[model samples]
Target: MNTKAFLEPMGSWAWWRSWFLIFFGCAVMGTGFVLFINPYNFVPGGVYGLGIVFHNIFPSVQVGTFGYMFDVPLMIIAMLIFGGQFGTRTVLAALFTPGYMNILTRLVYPDAAAVESLDPALLLGGRLDLSNDLLLTCVIGAVVIGVGQGIVVRQQATTGGTDIVAMLLQKFAGIKFSTGILLADGSVVLSGLVVIGFGIGTAEAEPAGWMLTLYSLITIYITSRVIAYMLDGASYDKLLFIITDKHQELRQFILEDLERSATYLKGKGMYTEAMKDVIFLVVSRREVRLVEQKIRSIDPRAFVVVTDAYDTYGEGFKPLPDADTIQAE
Candidate 1:
C-alpha cells in the first residue's frame, strides 16, 4: 500500500496553520506535565505519568527522557501495525513534546541539582506550590493537558504514547478502544501505587498515595470531559417529535417561518386507533423555543417531545468526515 495515499495535500495557509496548532498544542501539554503533574508526582496515566514513577526510581533521568524512551518504540510499533496512518504530524508531536518538557523542566528549575530532587518549593520559585492544595493542582493540570490535547486532536493528530498501546490492544486482543485506554492507564496508575504509594522507590511509605491516586482519577475524568467539550461544543441541537392534528399548518410554519426542514412519520394512535403524522425536526437550541411557540400556536394540545441531538451532520450541519481522512486518537 502507498502510504502517501493517506496523506492529504493542503494549501500553504492550511499547512502552516496545522503545523502551528501541533507545535502550540505540544508546548501546552508539556507545560501541564512539567509544572503541575510532575513536581508533586501526580501520575495521571500516560508515558509521562510512568516517567514520573520511573523518575522516582531513577532521579537522574528526567521525566521527558522516559517519555521519549516509551514514545519512540510505541510509534514504531504503531506504524508497523497501522501503516502510514501514523503520519508525520504524529511523529513530530510524539518526539517534540518530550523535548519541550525537558526544556521547560530545566527552565522551571534553573539549578541543575534541583531537577532530580523534585522540590516543590524550587518549582516555579514556589509561586505555583500547590503542595497544600492537591485537588486544585490536579484540576489545573487536567484542564491544561486537555486543552493541549484537544488542540492536537482538532488537527487530527495525536501525541502518541499509551494511546498507541490502546490501539494495538484493540487490534490484537479485540478489546474495545475505550477499554484498552482504561487498561493501559490503569496499569500505569497501579505502578505508581507500587512505586510511589508503597514507597518502593523512596523507601518512605507515603500515607497520601491512595489520595493522590484518587485525585489522579479525577484529573483523568476532567481531562476527558474537557477534550470532549473542545471537540463537540457545549451546546447540543434540539430534536423534536410532534404528533398533532395540525400537521399541514405546523409543516408550513416550519418551512416558511423557521426556514427549516422536518420529516413526517405516519403513525397510528395506540388508544384512539386513528392515523396521525409525527413531525420529526432538528433545530438549534435557540430556535427550539420558536418552534415550540409556533407549535403551541398551531395546536395547544399537540403531543410534543424535545430531546438533545449531540451530533448532527447533514446539509445544514457539520460536514461528514472525508473517507480518506485519518484521525489519530
Candidate 2:
C-alpha cells in the first residue's frame, strides 16, 4: 500500500474529533445551567442569565424555550453571513440545550415552593430565609455557571446560543467580543429587575435581582481572567546573553560550574582592534538569577542581557542533554 500517498493529506479524524469536542463542550455548559443555577433563582452572566430574566418577566415562558427561540434568528443570520461551520455549531447548541433546561427546570421547580433552607450554615450565615435573597443566589450561581462556560471555551466550542452571536457581532460589526457579550448579558440582567409582578424600582422593593446580576458579572470576569492567565504563557524558562572580553573564563565557568550551555559570538570592538565574545545561554528563571550573580562576581564590567522565553525544545532547555556531557560539565 502507498503509505506515503495516504499520509499526504490531513483527513477525517480531525473533523470527527472536532464534532466530539463540540458536543462535550455544549453538554458541560448545559449541565451547569440545568443542574446548578436554574432552579436556584439566580442567573449567571451572559445569555443564560437573559433566559432567567425572560422566564421571570413572563412566567409563562420557559428559559429553555426562550433560548431555543432567541437563538434561531441569530443562527440564521450567522449562517447567511459566515457559512456552515458557524451555523451548524450554533444550531447544535440551541437545539440540545433547551430540552435539557426544560427537563431540569420541571424536576426542580414544579409547584415546589422555595422551602426554608434547612442547612444550618444557610440559616446562620444567611440572615434571611434563603429562598428570597438574590445576593446569595447570584454569588453561588455565577461560580457554577461561569465554570460551565469556561469549559466550553477551553475546548474551543460554543454553549450554542448568544456566544455564537457575540462572536458574529465581533467579527462582522467590529464590536469587541467581551463588549458584545456584556451588552447581550446586561440586557438580560436588567430585565431581572421586573420579574413576577415585583418591581425593584420602588424605594421599598429590594434590588435582589440586580445584586445577583452584579455578582454574576464579577464571577464571570474573574473566571475568564483566570482562564486567560493559564493559557497565555509558560513562565519557567529565560534567555541570557553576556557581551564581554572575559568570555573564555565566563564560558568555562558557566559550562563547568552550573553545568549549562553557552554560545560564543565573534565580534569586533568599535574603536580598539580587539575581538570580543558574546555568550548566550538558555536556562530556567532561577538559573538566570544564578548566572547573573556569577557573572557579576567574576567581572563587574561584563555587559549582560536577559529575556523571558516561552520554552526551549532541544538540549538543556527541554529534552535532557546527553548525560555524559552534563556530568563532564
Candidate 3:
C-alpha cells in the first residue's frame, strides 16, 4: 500500500508531468534572472548571481552564458563526487536554464542579435539615476525567481549551480545543505559587495552601493520563503496522535479504508493513570476530516491531537536522498 511505489514507470504520464514542471520552472527562473535580476545587478547568489557580477565587468558576455560556464563545471564535480545522485534531469535542468535565459532575452529584445547587446537599463528606461528604486526592483525580481525555483523543487529537481555544490559539501564535508547554501551564497553576496564597490566609488558603468547588498539579502530571504510556500503551503500534511481504547478498529480503518499506515505506542494517561493506546500517523490536509470522522465514529471520546508535519520523508513521502545522488546512510 506504499503510494510512492505506483509513481514513475518509464515514460509514464507522471514522468512527462515531472519533466514539464521542471522545464517550465527553469524557464520562469531564467526569465527572472535575465530580464529582472541581472539587469538590476541584484546578486541574490548562485550561478545566476555570479553571472551578474561577471556580466557587469564584461558587458559583452550574456549572463546566461556565464551561468552555463559555471553550471557545467559544477555539475561535473557533482557527478564525480556523488555517483547516481546527479541524473539526466539535473543535467537537463542545468543546461536548459542558461539557454532559455538567452532565449528569453532574445524574445524580449528581438532586434538585438544577442541578449548581451541590449542595454541593461533599457527595461527601466534608464530612469534609475533620477529615482533610485533598487528595493522595489529587488522584491519583484526575487518573487519571480522564488516562484520558478519553487516549481523546480516541487518536481524534485534542482537548477544545479550552487545547489549541486551544497549537496557535494553535505556529502563530503558533512555540512548541512541549508548551512552550505548560506555559506556559499553568503560568500557570493560578499564578493558582489566588493565587485560592485559599495560606498567606495561609483564606476562610470554599473554603479554599486550598500543598498544593493542589503537588497540582495532581502531578495534571498523572500525567495526562500516563496519556495517554502510553494513546496509546503495549504496542502501540507498533518501528523495526528490519537489516544483511544479502540486501537484495533482504528488501525483497521487506517490500513484498509485510508490505505495508509499507522504506528501504535503504549502509554499511560497522566491524569487518569490509565493505560492508553496511542495511534500516530500522518495524512494529507484533505484527509483530516475523514480521519476525524472515523475516529469519532469508532471512539467518540478519543483524545486526538493534530500538528503540522512541515516535511515528511519516507516511503510514502519525499525521498530521503537526492534523486540522482548516492543516498547517504
Candidate number with greatest TM-score:
1
Clashing pairs for model 3 are 84-324, 85-324, 85-325, 86-324
TM-score (all chains, Cα) for each model:
0.89, 0.60, 0.74
User: RMSD, each candidate, Å?
Assistant: 3.0, 10.0, 6.1
**Per-residue lDDT of model 1, residues 1-329, tens digit only:** 23553355755678778889988998998899888899888888889999999998988999999999998878777666666644566788899999999998999896888899778789988887889999999999999998898788677667888767756675677774444556788888888888888998676866788888888887777776666666677789999999988878888888898888889899898998999888889999999999899889989999999999977889788888664333222
* TM-score head-to-head 1 vs 2, winner: 1
lDDT of 1 at 280: 89
Which is the leading candidate under lDDT?
1
Candidate 2 ranges with C-alpha deviation above 4 Å: 1-13, 107-140, 154-156, 173-176, 194-207, 226-329
What C-alpha lDDT, on a 0 to 100 scale, does residue 130 get in candidate 2? Answer: 45
lDDT of 2 by residue, 94-209 (tens): 67767776765555442323211122123323343345554555445455544555445444445655566566666667664545565566555555545512554333333455
Candidate 3 lDDT over residue span 182-274, tens digit each? 667887887778777453232543354567788898888777667667755646699999988788899899999989898888899788898
Q: What TM-score should be assigned to candidate 1?
A: 0.89
User: Candidate 2: worst 10 consecutive residues by lDDT?
Assistant: 320-329
